[model samples]
Target chain A: MAGETVTLSSLVTWLSRFRDLVTENRNYLTELDSAIGDADHGANMARGMAAVMEKVGASPATTADELFKSVGMTLVTSVGGASGPLYGTFFLRFGMTAGAVSEFDGAALSAALRAGLGGVVARGKPELGDKTMFDAMSPALEAFDASVASGGSPAAAAAAAYDAAVVGRDATTPLVARKGRASYLGERSAGHLDPGATSTAFLFQALAESLAQG
Target chain B: MKKLINSPDHVLADALVGVELAHPELKVDHTNRIIYRGEPTKPGKVALISGGGSGHEPLHGGFVGFGMLDAACAGEVFTSPTPDQMQEATKVADSGAGVLHIVKNYTGDVMNFEMAAEMAEAETGVRVESVVTNDDVAVEDSTWTAGRRGVGVTVLLEKIVGAAAEEGRDLAAVASLARTVNAQGRSMGMALTSCTVPSAGKPTFELPDDMMEMGVGIHGEPGRHRVPLAPAADIAQQLVEPILHDLDFSGAPTIVMLNGMGGTPLIELYLMYGEVAKILQKSGIQVARSLVGNYITSLDMAGCSVTVLRADDELLRLWDAPVNTAGLRWGV
Candidate 1:
């Protein structure tokens, strides 16, 4: 967290905060999913994050690649829904992009997050208006990279990402979904907050909070 | 919410134990959450594996036996099984003739199976072929979204394809037959009420007392739209017409199933079947074989679905073939 570089500890702390955020909002996420999905989003997120944390806790990972690889694989194996593979691939890609490094400066973080988002897009085949996690995460990464390019500190970049993600999540309310289970609703999908987008917002919020400590 | 279980979180795990105790004919792999026939896949027989969320009893799991699936993975209620579970089943079920994964067309199920197919092949050198069944006519736009939710036709496909696999068809033939069964079937479902997932502990959606949700997916997802509750005959018309319209069922031997959603009684299901049968008769669709009752269901959703598979002699033969399984028992 010193200077602009996020140490391995900070990344783990970020993951821990993300886990806590998902666990706390599990019911809320499920409620959102119930409106448009299977009503398991909350339960799925809670269980998946809990599984990720368990893997993280057991024989703690010393490097970014080792950390998020387990995080991704754990989620992919423990969580059965679309979120499992999508989020799992995100972390797996992030870890792969991060290589064996223990610290990520602002630019490096942007590249890592960008790669994670690319993985999600590749896995889900989602478009911007698809009312998926991509809707939130895509914009958040853009804001993160934009702030970083403007010479913003890591904390400021993360804050920008979090703010953009919230805006992106809220913008989904009026959208008619074109993908996922919600898309099965067609017209009825409009006016409902996408559960995936909501969770993705939480992911960014956790990032911003972790970086705020710096 | 008032489900018979030790706890919400342990519903799947606890139910696996019950599945083991109740069915000695099948073997339950508790750690992997798979249900297999008492014996391993017969050597050289192409194994057929299918699974999905647990609430739909006798489906994937109960169908595992001599002439049906070799193994079935069980996910938490209303959730697709993980890839690792599917991979485990794939590895165990393979006997050098390869394995066929009969996946329901849900996004989660498709993705998980896709991953399992790749992983199983990569890790164990087991060849895996998959057939994703999307027989529900409910989701009108197949080119878009996740397409139709796989429903009752899955039962029909499992029986038909499983028989073919048991007959020692290669993976290519078994997988192709599975696809043919999927293409030839169409289904429509309606729900009188929304079912609650044990962990969610509440109705997934609310339907007014006088209204009914039509075209419902198996998970209690909101269907095409809600309509006023009607008589059994009218409800049958609503369910059967769309299926008939979606495909040409006339002049073909069709397998019809009037499947109940979990909560409806046998008496009501038979009554609904009567109405459904009448419509098919009037429409000139010959029913070569018929199955009624809760073959596939949403837990506690007081409703029914009708699956019509336009079949030929081959499918009918497989359908009639001796099969021994917990959910289905006949010629065997």
Candidate 2:
């Protein structure tokens, strides 16, 4: 398990898978957002991810850092909402933490995830239970780290993170929003699933499915 | 669903064509979607830039010209502009004195502008300062939210602060004036109907014919509450009271703007302004200046918002300065 490593190809596959997931669930995310947000999360994310896919597909970025940085820049320039900066900063920090390495062992992956999450927290300033992407992202990182510490494979750790993300995403329902446009709803923000947490869950699920295929 | 648009996807691009054609004084960059003053920023003068989603006509973009914003970044309908667009605009708008970013208090706009400011400074070594306007008193400033929104005050702030920048004030003084304007102003908006985002191709929310949303944001987000529709007098009271209660506007001479929310007619806006003016007079708030029209708006949302900026001699002087822009113009 300690010797199992994820290659740059897996990273590319992970992003492609996430892009498809976002495309498939575009309307669903928008519908969730309509309840409490500006009702463009799905459309914005889909557009941003499509641009990211195109850029990453064209670039010959063999290193993990180069790949993630390209993805980050694409999202930052393409997506024009909270999702743009939050996800863009996440990947930028992830790339910076992963450095020029072309591959990531379980330990390296855990550290990169932590770094990405830290970037999100710094950019968005969301506290726990704020019903943001942080809700899902925070738990997913913890699960990934716990699985890696238990000497699991990258695929196993991703699967663990995906499961935790799902739970965290679902828990956003009935919780009031405290950040982003959804917070404008105040008490009405409850009884609705957070669009950001839902999309973040898809991100981890895509990661799990992509790594497992390898 | 029935809009004059060629297609949902082409709305912004097609509209920019009209914007450029209509306003020859502006330079529209179609690729980056930034609107700049045809005339570059004067040397040693602070430049001002403001932007947000595109549905709000004449806001950040239409206001870019002499004595106003030097540049404006345009995003997709009801979405914040991307950082690259802001970075480019920042670089181009900067004079030797530096640049000031006038941002609305939406989360996306704030984050993107912050990133752009940082990038512009690091990459190009241009000095950048920013002031975020969050004068909407309707949204309670609580721990769970991003605080009050930058509503009608943003329009007034841009004009007043833009005048200050035009006066050759340095970046710090201009930025401070912008913040002071924001602190001295308050706004409240209401909506008779929800707006349709071009991409969404439907109303953001459904409103009953008999009910109206109060405390509405510019993006068609639902307001604080919905109640049975009332007369213009009652509606004006609803809008003005929240603003007045939030701040004591009685003593100072206040600048008032009755801004239309895109779909509302000028006649209705004027009528709303009349009602609002009556209320202010009764409350002993002296109106130093008044503007009634759509300056900031939601896309095709039928409503009006009231903005009151408490003014002293200096603010009034700045407000009286010549301004030449598509959305607002006086003494040009």
Which one is best on TM-score? 1
Give the alpha-carbon lDDT of every model: 0.90, 0.91
Candidate 1 error regions (>4 Å): none
**Could you give candidate 1's per-residue lDDT for residues A35-62 as a string of tens digits?**
8888898998899999988889986988
Per-residue lDDT for A135 in model 2? 98
**TM-scores of the candidates in the order shown:** 0.99, 0.98
lDDT of each residue in B87-152, candidate 1, tens digit only: 999999888899999999888888888889989999999999999888888887767677788888
Report the C-alpha lDDT of model 2 over B1-332, residue by residue, as the tens digit: 87999998788899999999998888999999999999889999999988898888889898998988999999988889998999999999887789899899999999999999999999999999999999988888655598888889999999999999888998999999999999999999999999987777678889999999999999988888888999999999999998999998878899999999999999999999999999999999999999999989998999999999999989999999999998889989
